[model samples]
Target: MKKIILLSFLAIICSTTGCKKFLDKVPSSFVAPENYFNNEKEVNTALNGVYDILSREQTFGGQLPIRHAVSTDESFFSYASFPTGPFYYNFGADDATIRDLWRYLYDGIERANVLLANLDKANMDEGKKSVVKGETLFLRAFYYFILVQNWGGVPLKLTPTTSINNVNIPRNSVKEVYDQILKDMVEAEGLVKKISDIGFGGRVSKSAVRGILARVCLNMAGYPLNDVAKFKDAATWAAKVNEYGEHALNPDYSQVFINLCKDQYDIKESIFEAELYGSNSDAFREGGRIGNENGVKCSASTDLIPTVGFAYGFVSTTRKLYTSYEYNATDASKRDLRRDWAIATYTLNASGVKANIAATNIYARNCAKWRREYEVVTPKNKNYTSTNFQILRYADVLLMLAEAENEVNNGPNATAVNALNEVRRRGYGKLLAGATNPANADYPGAISLSKAAFLKVIQDERARELCFEGLRKSDLIRWGIFVNTMQATATEFTTYAAMTTTIYKNARDAAQRVTATHLLYPIPILEMSLNKAMVQNEGY
Candidate 1:
């Protein structure tokens, strides 16, 4: 229940002053489990190390979200020459980003393993010990989930790697890995505290465990697994979180993000997020990246300057996403309020003047979710803003419940319809009284639909609501439309290229690059080389 000072704790865990290569399996000499985890303070310190990895530039801090956004129809890099080859689906075994992502995830898993293996030795209170155990289990399951989703069956390391011999463990089957994830989450559900008791969304809680279980079950129900019965399980788990009643949608969609920038954790909406803090200098001194990667490009100091200035144009919303915003059929004046807040139509020039992007410039739109201007305290450096990266939210729970309910029942039921409408009501800025004027009336109420029709509507609604939040590609993959969607986007790019020479010619080429094999990333070249037992994914 206490606020952990992450920076100071990171200093304790990473005190050993050696820079090892990213994939090197050498253990740090200073904080080895034999020397650390001897006391309650030490065990808590080790847990901080697990949380620290989530802030790394290669993982949640930047690359992971950027990769997910650009690889899908939700976004793309602005410049033709931007080094986004992997995101374009053009990279192979030697891609450094993919390799870094693999290493970072495994590194976190290693920390969690060490903590779990030695927690019993620490002289902590029994209640606190259970909380720590639950958190570590959740963290380990989370890392494995990301690995299984991206790389398929990876080496499942359940224990601490005490020596070099244990490092070369072979990859496990996808089902085996998922089985462990589900097992860990189910155990975590009972051990962790409720969200209200924890008072912050950053820590793992009962609601967080249920929320992740719902997500994993949904994945099991779709795509390669096609375990249709899991749809009922997914809906049941998501509904449990709703029934808990500790989380709900924030009235103004924009304020949710504004609150995040100001370090006001919204337990009612943001269920879980990777906590980030300090200025750019703080990140540099502490060996961490400050904020998320998505933002507008700006020249001078403005409210958007701190967060958006560091944005390298590596990812921006696509035209497909821009046009997905729905409007009230009866009242032409009303439109989805999420459109402008999620995507920037204009940017500030060098002199701090607003400049409209040309209509033909398809790549100019930037994600506005990480605005720095809303921070109560100005950032010390442009690169580091204290905006936490939202991982799970209550809106997602409602939508997932709706989708799974439809899939299980073969039509939209009363429960599914109400859940779906609650999200829509908030999106139209009508959930909170006085949040919107009469001009923005309640979202033309929910409609009745069959299974097929409702599923299509939910897919489009997710795109409109959660675009640029790093979940788009996986959503498409689960729906069995990833390849088809990419091919269709490529066709659209080809037409845009004909109309304007500024657009990257290869944009169309890359859009068509996704194949069945491209669905999972190939084993990183370093991993394959280091562990001969590790086999590469199909198609290079």
Candidate 2:
């Protein structure tokens, strides 16, 4: 995966993040598909264009992770000014953010379609060519997966868009869209390389494909499409990753995220992540607001900026996430260590020093998972830092298997219990990657519990382990408890928690605004106006 330079428009433009802009434009000097991809080099260039979408502001780079994904039970937008935005659950079809997200996803799919349609034109080795084709197919399926989950059913375009005149297409059913996704991913499983061969988390690997396949199956088993049979398939795919024995959880829970911040690849723990590098200081605009938007709040003093970097800390942790971890009354080591690291207990002062936050002030703490102070890039930009964001990891795979196996068996078996307990052991600092465990943190009580009771454990454990990683809102929605969870959190903020007037209003209003319509965003106004076949989501 050559990630530094993303070339698009058939190699006519070469920029660190050029394909995002190229998608919206018809280059005056057009390079036809037949004119390019005459060699392996050109074929690889087209594949880079497909991967570039993951770095765009509309996808994993910024908007998806920072703004759209944070407003959940675990966290919320800290500022109170913007009442008509997706973060506050007050946006509509006319919202710019919603429009951009819809367009960029289709743009990524189009890139993949062109590459897949023209891959064999290049004179390349059969082995290498197959890998590229597999990657492109997986990416196309992944883009449609995002669309189907967010908008219920979007226009499905499989072939390349040859003309601007033939753009109006009808929406596919949710089941039809998911079937295509599974079809592509199941084929990709046999063609992609192993994580051990890649030795990095940026590119798609056999493990990544399997892990994400499990996730897609779990989504189908829940929510609007209650295909209960997919639970067995989900468990099967997740078990394949664990059976491979190539990935494991890094003993320390915080190090899994810190490895991402430092641009270090721990393939054993991190299965796949978005590659972000080089703040514009070096003339490459590839960096994103992963650290700046969700990190600890900092004053932009020249003295403090040099060491600690700058962050708006717009996303704040909620009391629900704070209390999810086990707390020991007197002993600190006996407690789960994830709470303090995921939720910031301190802020950086102007003097580049750590100022401890008071214990009573829980709601004001920032999302501390991706702290900018640990970024290794020199002269970091205030608005963007070179911090890569994790999309899939080994811990998530374990949890998915546990959840699926529970549903399939009507209760948790030993394999399911052990898979989940492995993550818990590391969260308690009882298990290291290779060292022998001195004490086991396995839940002895969970073994005898009913299926309903054990599902609750999986839910709380996911919030405790994977918080602020951009998966909470979707997880809540898939479980069919998103609206209830938001309404419950809103009541908790107003009735029980100690909060200031403005914080109470902002937090309560955002949660209470969620309705049945919010499960999926409405069709963007621009899209509806342009595509005659499009219909708006209900209650929008």
Candidate 3:
């Protein structure tokens, strides 16, 4: 079935140019719905089209993650010569990146809608049909989730866009959009298969639906919605995944990426990921670009060789992120293993020797999680890579469970503490003997804190764990600290400016531009120009 799906996908891509011929013909040239979704194979082929949107550069491929990281304090453009205006929040309705993202998300939603509207009409097994319908619902809901979070309220185009009249639809309320998302998720949870049945993290499963539900519930429980009651629901959904027992944290965090780079999917740790198939030809560019955007620039032939000169030293880790790891009080050797693995503290010099980043060269602190060197086949073009971008991991599930538990109970409980400890234990390498070592070990012990204190801890923990993965901005927004955090980051940049030349000066200036108005990006100018009923977000 997988092979059939892959072949059908390639066929669709190869035949895409057929649309140009349709432009020259009359209305009769279009394929009718009855002719398209006729059987199981046709429906499956359509389903593959929906999945393909996720791999686009505007979606998970590049812009989405890059903009998310640069918009926050998690990362910065290493060189002032590179485009840094967007990182400084200088972009507005005319921004190309924002426009591309908006279009890509709606495109995904539309593809899902086309599949869903005709799913029941297809000739397929009852169980298989249900799986297809459920996957479409999950994909559509996921697209809306991203839209609502970024744009606040957007047009809720649920049905397949079959006519020109549907193009003028108005924007819905954030609450209305979220309501639809939760509805689809609830239905999807019951219809999707278990992870054991699929045997791959790329496909939607019941546990993935639950995990996303927990994430959605958390968003509702915060900022815009402020529905405190939803915290219990979040906890419930997260606990379900925790008890599912199919997913577990890989003991070695570094190995997870190594496996992904090798195109070896680990369903145990990565509950869901955007699949990227590498290729050496420009004609079939399907690989990921995260490695090129994040890896450090070096002149030596070491494990961390520089790829594209432009992107080689493009994105740099922020000082705040570099210092997020925990250190042993007495033992210098005992530190959070993820620190060096996740971020580059040093790089190979021209002599192939490790060189620590000095005050004069802060760009050396590049992100290492998506290193291109680990790829099984080195990409012919540095802009493309084979590494998969994880969407949801078991560690994220455990952390969400901890957060929701604390929010609902007004303090941490044994269940919540245990979940938090599990992640920390793995981060410290999960050694029973080392667990007791005060010098270098796991979480010191169970945490006891008030509601406010525990919530703060969870926020900090999330930044430390998920730093370059594109969740920081949304996390900060939900906590109602987006503006304040950026303001504080600006002050931190000033201190950093004192140690460097004009490079740090430009960064400090950009960081200072973050304000309350930036809480939600302006509704793209193009979108507003097209829809008369569409209103721009406040302070745009």
The sequence of per-residue lDDT tens digits that candidate 3 reaches over residues 1-540 is: 111123334234212222222111111225655567778888887787777667666677665676555646777655666454466677888787777777767767766776787788887899999999998899999999999998898888887654433335577999999999999999999999998788888888988999999999999999889888999999999988756688888878888778776778778888887777654244445665766666655554443333421136556677787777776758654667787777876665565465777744443577777765566664335466656778888888898999999988889888787887777777777633345543244344446678788777778778777777788888888889988888787788877645365556666666778887777778777667656677888887
Lowest lDDT 10-residue stretch of candidate 1:
15-24
Instruction: Give me the candidate number with maximum lDDT.
Output: 2
Candidate number that wins on lDDT, 1 or 2: 2
TM-score of each: 0.91, 0.95, 0.89
Tens digits of per-residue lDDT for model 1 on 286-394?
A: 2223223566655655564544444444567767887778656586447678887888767767565668888666556778776655655444355555567778898
Q: List runs of model 1 lying over 4 Å from the truth.
A: 7-26, 283-292, 301-310, 328-333, 358-363, 377-380, 435-447, 497-504
Q: What C-alpha lDDT, on a 0 to 100 scale, does residue 402 get in candidate 2? A: 93
lDDT of 3 at 471: 83
Q: What lDDT, from 0 to 1, does candidate 3 have?
A: 0.72
lDDT of 1 at 533: 76
Residue 531 displacement (Å), model 2: 0.5
Candidate 2 displacement at residue 38 in angstroms: 1.3
Off by more than 4 A, model 2: 1-4, 8-29, 433-440, 497-500
What is the alpha-carbon lDDT of model 1 when measured against the actual structure? 0.75
Model 1 vs. true fold: TM: 0.91
Tell me model 2's lDDT, rounded to 2 decimals.
0.82
